[model samples]
Target: MSDAFFSEVTGRIPYAGLDSTDPLAFKVYQPDRLVLGKRMEDHLRVAVCLWHSFNWPGSDVFGVGTFDRPWLDARLDPLVAARAKLDAAFEFLAKLGVPYFCFHDRDVAPEGKTWADTQRTLETVIDQIAGRMEQTGVRLLWGTANLFSHPRYAAGAATNPDPEVVAVAAAQVRSMLDATKRLGGENYVLWGGREGYETLLNTDLAQEETQHARFLAMVAEHKHRIGFKGMLLIEPKPQEPTKHQYDYDVATVRGFLERHDLAGEFRLNLEANHATLAGHSFHHEVAAAIAAGLFGSIDANRGDYQNGWDTDQFPNSVDELALALYEIVRSGGFGSGGFNLDTKLRRQSLDRTDLFHAHIGAIDTLARSLLVAAALIEDGELERLRAERYVGWSGDLGRSILKGDAALELLSVRVLSGDIDPRPVSGRQEMLENVVNRAIWSVDRAELAAIGTPVGAAGRG
Candidate 1:
């Protein structure tokens, strides 16, 4: 576990402040620095994802693998390679000082020839991972079942027309759910990769919807039966492998949960790239989820603006994430959820140090964004303006209308009789944007360091 594979990165990454020249040091992410009355690490419960960091072979559909990972080499025995991968993964996690990690069932273990063999392999790997967690104090943020990669789920998992395929999906989910409980994961996530129709010609919309709802209900029941104390999360994406997905966005998932009577059991795991794909901003999706009280977790990645696909690149721009973090702050911050780095290294970034570089930059982006969000909240002008804009809602007429005390005839008579001439006013959108800009620019490393941190804590190391 002591830097088993990543030989170059020695010891844990330290907070070297904003002026540090060292690439391996954390510039803005000081875990112990106080933000909004709590330690920075407690506010941003960041996690490293196993799938993209370890399992992905740096190969796209058009090319061969380019990474220098011998553990992913197929010539070696699967079990031995898996063990090696686990060792390296733990080393990276410990050195990075991340509190939690996430994984898919397939990401942790290679699939075997038979179902029983796969299960056993997964169990062995899970045991190894548990031991590593105990040694390093790194916890599982969540665990998921990869329902789309295999041929058995080509059509769909629960929404498949074949009952046997649906049963297979159920079995996989059950096994992974049990593994999550065994690992003491904080949440369980469901990513419906192909749980939607490609074409209407052969799709029975009503039947598929019913089947999906039933499958979710069964999973919820199993979670309770097993006594797993974790939040149930579902991710939303507009489309990728399929033409459309049921969980397209926060609003769509909210309606689906309401229709299935499963609103109380699941929450939304928002992703920045997925939000962009769904024709919305990350801020818009976070706001939507917060409004519906379904905000649970986030997958920290950004999509390419030039292209229309999920790029899954590490976040770099604070401006892109500030408003979204603002929404998270307004909603009282994450409860059982955290920011999991669901990102990939560029194909050309094959050097071992690039992994640390990617994560370090993304973590700093979120850290700076938290500062901007806190400043906005403390400023009071933004919220005050919002409240003033809606001040009329607190009036007697507004209350009566909402209470159903004013009928259409009564309202029309009042409007006609009373000289109630209403006119539209400016929303001051530009002014508000300027205020946010001010908050972003006004945040200073010196000021932040002065609050609850040792002198020169923010200085160059």
Candidate 2:
């Protein structure tokens, strides 16, 4: 193919209204349309990820890559292929009309024999990507270093027992941080993809933790030294490449950050699939992050209900997404982070244009979810009810207990006086569920098909 890489899709994907039936059009995701006194694009800053969208070859454990991406063929010169891949990716991003994209350092540039050579190659590509971004008006959401893919990181990266491997990982992060700043990326992410031990037999738990903390401390220090203004983000996954991940979930990561005194230095980049893998719902993770003021960005994807691992399938469930968005909107929106589509197509959907279809549908889903979330927020029922449930905590006794003026002995005396006897109140869980359902159902979809009924993960708002 020529430079017009996505020739199958001739032009930009336009935003048609809800009544439009054009297959390639965005029915609900009108970027400029106002949702809550702000442009929808500003509220939901949607982005595509380069790693899964282009770098991955549609391969799985049991099969080779089945997609028809010529750039992925190993026979071609890597630098040549990298330029071609960037061309295709820019064409796709420009046509899809997404405002931003995210990437790992290796996704756009192949490594060289020496560390200096590797940096040189990456530098060339970074300049190229920056030029193309200027032309296309797309931005970099975040940049990360892929530390787990290489064999050198089979044991771990920051937590590796071997000091050299840890040093290499640090170098990669440093380069990625530089690249992110150079590209005007809004955030720099760290996913300790292999930062955990498979077993304790060969692991020094405390030492590994200390090493990981030290690595993070260095990263934070480097960010200031380089004057990179973006947020430092850490992505959490329970387990995958390793039996246990140090950043297991949002709460786990929060604890780790606080323990290391790095909580203020970094925020979370929550992934829906990772939340599922951690045996929690996506909204649970989102709410937890928002509650603790750790919410930064989102990896917008879902996992298969039947599968027990990280599926990373395109998010099609508006119900689940709405709840998470509710938490996001209620918390006064993201600081400098946005929704990056950390999604991939099913191996079987091999058409060249399947990429367009997957993204179009997912984008519309996000738009509708935002509508529902905004509606719920405006309705104010959930918040009112939630506050009512905790009304006792605002009482004199509550303030006394919180201020440490009411001692345990005094509380025991009060309980023994029988005046503190209390009866349970109705949680009205189903009624709260109805409030969300009503919002979703009442959305003004002109003639579009109804979305699926929510699979209950209960309330996360």
Candidate 3:
């Protein structure tokens, strides 16, 4: 594929270290740099999502499309426009030097009025995308179906009251799965966009839950039948367009998987913005998912703390991401999972160069965070302190309680007879905070010097 879309970007983005003042160059995201005995690229495995980068036209509830995209011009035919978009997407990915990309069936192809037409359009686009991937060595990280956009799924998809609508959704998912397998995608994601109700007064909660479970089972069985080797991930979001989403959080999805007998087949894809929406921190969600052994992937983006809605802003906080990466590293790192930048450009960022700037910043932020996390692990003080705090859990009493060998009655008898007076111990919260702060500050100081920022001069002013 020719670099027709981003002709201005010239060649591939290069790692120029931190001293280079060029805006287009990567300062910290050296793909080949080793971290924790693995190449940075291998550890990060960042993938750009098409739905946000290519398909979204910077339109929101109150405004019309504000960005200029030739592929999305009204003058172009639907299929021709879809092909142009795919071409542009590949060029963008290649220029950015991203190893992988993700897309929804609808993001790559325009959905036709008829079901047959929709499938044919999607297949045709998939073939084109496959060719581009083969040529550029860019792999598909995952593929999904846009079940929430159309009016047909306003009520819900799999959890819809109407069986016909649910059947249609199943057909769409089947086609998406087939495409994913054909493209050698590493994973397939199901994001329940409208799989919740606006009001319980008109909804059948029990029936909806049962229907959702059955729907997941059907998809899992189909995945097995097709002999696809990719992981199946369910992304959790507390609520947005609906009052309550079924896959509300990591714990909720964990229970749901166990209930549906799909625990072995499906895992949670944690999203930072979604975690915030669920009234939790990003690291908290990652830890929860990792603890349950369900951490499969990440949708890398941050939400505005002041905004209640999904802002989907490009993540810029090195401190926040460093903590999240710490948990990710402690969990043995991503096996079949990778970070997908599920973020969008702000409406004001209309220039083509803004896309490059946004991605470059995000990639560098994650890379720096990975370095900080690695340093924290190497120092061992943080982990040692944490383990010391949980020393009671490694003792005989803790072991007996965990092994189910000691019941509440026995513990009560021992407590009463032994006259065991437990004294409260300080958590040393401030001291631990200082340790983390010092580590982050050390990294920040080093990075600033590397980037030619006079650290002491700024403070002296």
RMSD of each: 2.3, 4.9, 2.3
For residues 1-461, what per-residue lDDT tens digits would candidate 3 score against the true structure? Answer: 37688777998999887667899999899898778799999889999999988998889999977776788887899899999998888898998998999999999887888989998999899889989998899998889999999898999999999999999999999999999999999999999979888998999988999999999999999999999999999999999888899899999999999987889989888899999999999999999999898999999999998899899989998888999999999778998789999999999898767889999999999999998888788888999999998899898888999999999998999899975567899999999888777778788676676567787754443
Clashing pairs in 2: none
How well does model 3 score by local distance difference test?
Answer: 0.90
- Model 3 stretches astray by more than 4 angstroms: 444-461
Stronger candidate by lDDT (2 vs 3): 2
lDDT of each: 0.92, 0.91, 0.90
Cα deviation of 234 in candidate 3 (Å)? 0.3
- Scanning candidate 3 in windows of ten residues, the lowest lDDT window is 452-461
**Number of backbone collisions per candidate, in order?**
0, 0, 0
Q: Tell me the TM-score of each prediction against the true structure.
A: 0.97, 0.95, 0.96
Candidate ordering by lDDT (highest first): 1, 2, 3
What are the per-residue Cα lDDT tens digits for candidate 2 across 1-461? 23366787888899876556788999889898787898888988999999888998999999999887888889998889999899989999989999999999999999899999999999999999999999999999999999999999999999998999999999999999999999999999999989998998999999999999999999999999999999999999999979999999998998999999999999999999999999999999999999898989999999999998888889999999999999999899877999999999999888768999999999999999998999898889999999999999899989999999999999999999996888989999999999999989878642242333242421224
Clashing residue pairs in candidate 3 are none
